[model samples]
Target: MSATRRQILSGAGASVAGIAFTGALSELFAGSASAASGVRAPGDRPPRGGYGPLVPDPRGLLDLPAGFRYKVLSRQGDPLRSGEGPVPSNHDGMGAFPGHRGRVHLVRNHENKTTGKLGVPTVPGLTYDPAAKGGCTVLELDGRNHVLGERVAVAGTAVNCAGGPTPWNTWLTCEETEDKAGTNGYAKDHGFVFEVDGADPRRTGAVPLTALGRFQHEAVAVDPRSGIVYETEDAFDRPFGLFYRFLPRKPLGGTGSLRAGGALEAMRVPGVPDLSAVRETGTRFEGVEWVPVPDPLAAETPIRFQDFGPKGITHAQKLEGCYWGGRAVYFVSSFARTGDGSAATHFGQVWKYEPHRRRLTLVVVFGPSTDIRLPGESPDNICLAPTGGLMVSEDGGGAQHVFGVSERGEVYPVARGRQNIGTPEEPEWGEFAGVTFSPDRSTMYVNCYTPGTTFAVTGPWHR
Candidate 1:
């Protein structure tokens, strides 16, 4: 459930105003929906809950409501005009932007880590590591399923994780692996953030923004008003993961260039220690402070174990998706329950950070799940619907569905995904990721990581 208005800001669970945050679109939607019907295609199961409960997909690919429809825009093994062999698998985070005329530009992440597939190998001189199999692909599309063009936006990165959309209109693609230089073959360090131009993919040379520090970066959110960048770590080993903020020496410049010479710092709560240990759903921590990382590069040590660890920055479990909304940086922690090795009680927690107040508060959270058909367990990628509150892409086991959490703490289903049979003996059930809407808000786009597929959805989104 949601916290009181005051609780969302202050650490106290009190309500000051009955209001909805700018980023949460729950207010515009209805609480419960009349179960809808579906027509199953060959080898597909009946539909479950979604926008209108879900209608079975006749194509056996995706399920939607009565009026809604979906089209597979891009798929794995699809030939690209760009030299990047074929569309890579393990598609993760993504962002969409306005392009020429009525076209929209999309920069999608391919999270594959092995060198088996042809990663982002299209660019001539821009290849970072020819042997690495993780990078991003750029696509230009129109209102329908037509893919105007596609190409490699960047390459040579490992575990290219979820990044944020810069105010300067570039996608900051972060590498999730932490392989040292020359260790995993012959190449430079792995974990770094690279900026790719969405307006024109070919122009972006896949330059790494080293000033943001290197670690297991899960996601990033840039505060538009302050030009400060907030990052999340997905570390699982010793020293756990910590939240970070990178202050550019100079404010954000043109072309999405993250200026070097900036200081990276970890987040901490003054007196309320251990933000992760909080057991309640709306637990809040006010007056959050920033501790310098001293060596953000982490060449000698990971970001969590650095001096910043002893300084009292709160440690979290697998911090994932991050985004800017309602004057706060909304972030996600997959699971932190007692079973998750954390003292916390929730299976997942969503946090909100106020840049002006330098405060961090827990916003949305979920307990363990029993049914696989519902929005099970882990909540990964995040999206802000102007009229639908917060839509979360569930990365949980069993049924992979996109669930919505309202500002008032109410949770509901947005969509559900069905497994597409490809290779036998392998679980084709993929996470619904890289969720974003068209600039016009008429179409919604999402991806299934394996049996790699990208779908464009459109209908009465107001529901």
Candidate 2:
């Protein structure tokens, strides 16, 4: 039996209600609660039968399942409709929204720094820092996934990495660097979340949302109900990064509401100081609490180093993707290796946090794997599939792929990267980022981090 598009979009199995699996796939995830933690051995391969198997693209760009195909919506050097020089390089995190006249609007981030191959053109009003090269660009696509136009949404931010969409139809583009002013010729201290209005680029003021805290931010997820913004820090130093939540002063007031100011706090799980130490899946942390970051702006010290009492704030290595689904916030730790100073080693881990219940659960954990092609390794930029599971963009070594993980812990490959930007002797495949679906769930949009390409993929999504 073929799965419907709606079923494929919202079919999260047991992790999400109203979806059930049968036969082999069901048995793959049909273990005891403890046994269903989604942990695999180092050499264990991911379960197959996702969309059959990926067929290499004749164009040698992206490989998808037999019936699926992709179209290049935008490229690094492509001309923009707004007459802005060109689409900037290093396309990173992105958000897709319902566009005017049944179209789709995408706000894409360029992970450029002070110096890069091509910087986001610093338009007069859209630019925040003249010396910064990282920002966001807005792209409009028609029903057929044709690019209607592309323009700068926000600019002049440094190291724009991965961010999340807002409940108010905006995109939060984050800076993944803690570089301060006077460093790298920066005019102002970098590292803040900036809101981009995908529907109307003019509404994006290029103003930094300072209250959200200044740190090495990876991504954010806004709770549609409470309007609280959950942020992840991607610092990979000795201190690591903290999971943060911003209590917006104005709840769900739409764009620019975050600027009204709110409390920035770090998450603390009583006895757990570092998330990397927890190697087991399905590990539950009860009564999780948030502690105020005395210095969110990091005027004297970074938020992670700020005093959070005797227990101290919890920290994690490589805190990356974040999204809100099933009334909880889902976040990712891309990978934790002992050589990277982590207490434990793992390919990846997905965590779910229940706000009302103050409970945190490890939903999916990828065990150590030497194989770089392992589907679940280094899962980044995750989104809730309309069909019922989670889609993860791979950022680890080896051939890159966008992976799908069912709610019951069934893993499958959705798409693979076949583009080799490097020479044949040293083939290099860019990491996948910004794996998001359109409002209609008919298209899946993703980014190739290098040579910077944005693709709109559509096919038999329900298979």
Candidate 3:
């Protein structure tokens, strides 16, 4: 069925009945439950198959529930305005911004770092480090979430993975890998967060947010009230991964402010000392403190192995997605146990951070990763839902999916992915990324990795 404004407007009042987002933080607070609505808060156990059973898609592209449907917004090899080799592959993270004149802009990341011809070429002054690949592209969409035009926003970076949208209407794309300067043909030191305006791609700065610290950066979420940036590291090296907070010298500076420098600290439990966060689900920890990292940019040593390491700084395994939630920041630790102070389990873990209270809680966990029948596992990217919940993109071993969690933590398949079998050795079982909503909440945008496809999904979400 064709998605229309009427279909969404007719159900908006009814779906938002049980949930309400108010205050200046409405945009950042994706889906936080209200007690009056009879919805449970974070750290609560979710019911199995909460949304509904997945109804297979006849077209074998994606599976959705009865009323929900999706439309392919962009596909791999789609020619861009710059003709940049049909949009480089490995579409990782993305941000959807409100465009001028009712249009929507999507700043997408091409997770490219190869020496091949797939990366976006340099655009004179707009390029960061022309010697390196892996940058972002901007897509303009109409009111109905249809693609209008797309062009390279910023090129000349490395491993342009997931990032969060700033309150000032800019996109912060983070490089997942930390390839130093002059090494592996890299012209400059990689592993830094660069800001790009979705509206004007040419204005993207050529410098990185050095104050934000350099490690295997994955994703970030900024608290608008305080402008405190909460970051997650995907470093699988010796010291493992750690949750971080960037205390900028000035708040509300908006974009291009982090380059001035700031205090980067690691999240830690005050009295308990060393914490690996390798426990069961529903685990809660209070008195969380921020320990200063001796060095933000560690060339020889990993950032997590600095003075904070011996001080018993807390750490997790493969910290991937980070999102600003109700009075807190929720992050995900994608699978990794046994050797990193965690127990042997294939499932992933979700954690919540309360900035005001300085507390961290293990809200949701996907256990027994060996079980292929579970609702969700190894959640990679996450975003707020209009239903006052969360939508997570699964990057696990089994069939990929975009899982939806309710206010009470109910897990169900909101969308199922189909593997495009092109080569006998490889079936392109796409992993979903960039699960964000439109400015008006009429549509939810997501992406798949394998074939690099972006989709706009809409339906009776609350129902």
TM-score of each: 0.84, 0.88, 0.84
Residue 111, candidate 1: C-alpha displacement in angstroms: 0.6
- For candidate 3, the lDDT comes to 0.72
In model 1, the Cα lDDT at residue 355 comes to: 73
How big is the positional error of residue 354 in model 2, measured in Å on the Cα after superposition? Answer: 0.7
Poorest lDDT segment (10 consecutive residues) of candidate 1: 31-40
Write down the lDDT of every candidate, Cα atoms only.
0.69, 0.79, 0.72
Deviating ranges (above 4 Å) for candidate 2 = 1-48, 369-373
Best by lDDT: 2
User: 327, model 2: CA deviation in Å?
Assistant: 1.7
Candidate 1 Cα misplacement greater than 4 A, ranges: 1-50, 271-273, 337-340, 368-376, 406-410, 421-428
> Candidate 3 residues 361-419, lDDT tens each?
76665643323334444667777766665777767443566766565444455777775
Worst 10 residues of 2 by lDDT: 14-23
Q: How far off is model 3, as Cα RMSD?
A: 7.8
Which lDDT tens digits does candidate 1 get at residues 1-463? 2223112222111112122122233322221111011222242211222244556666666766568788888888888766558888778899888887888888899886656554656466566776677888888997674798888888777888799888777888888877887766737787888888877755667667888988888899887777788899898764568889988876677575475558888888776444567655456666788888878788798877766554566788878988776457777887765564665555566777777777666655454232222242566777765343456776644445665545453445555676654356543457788898887667788988866888888886654
Q: In candidate 3, residue 398 scores what lDDT?
A: 38
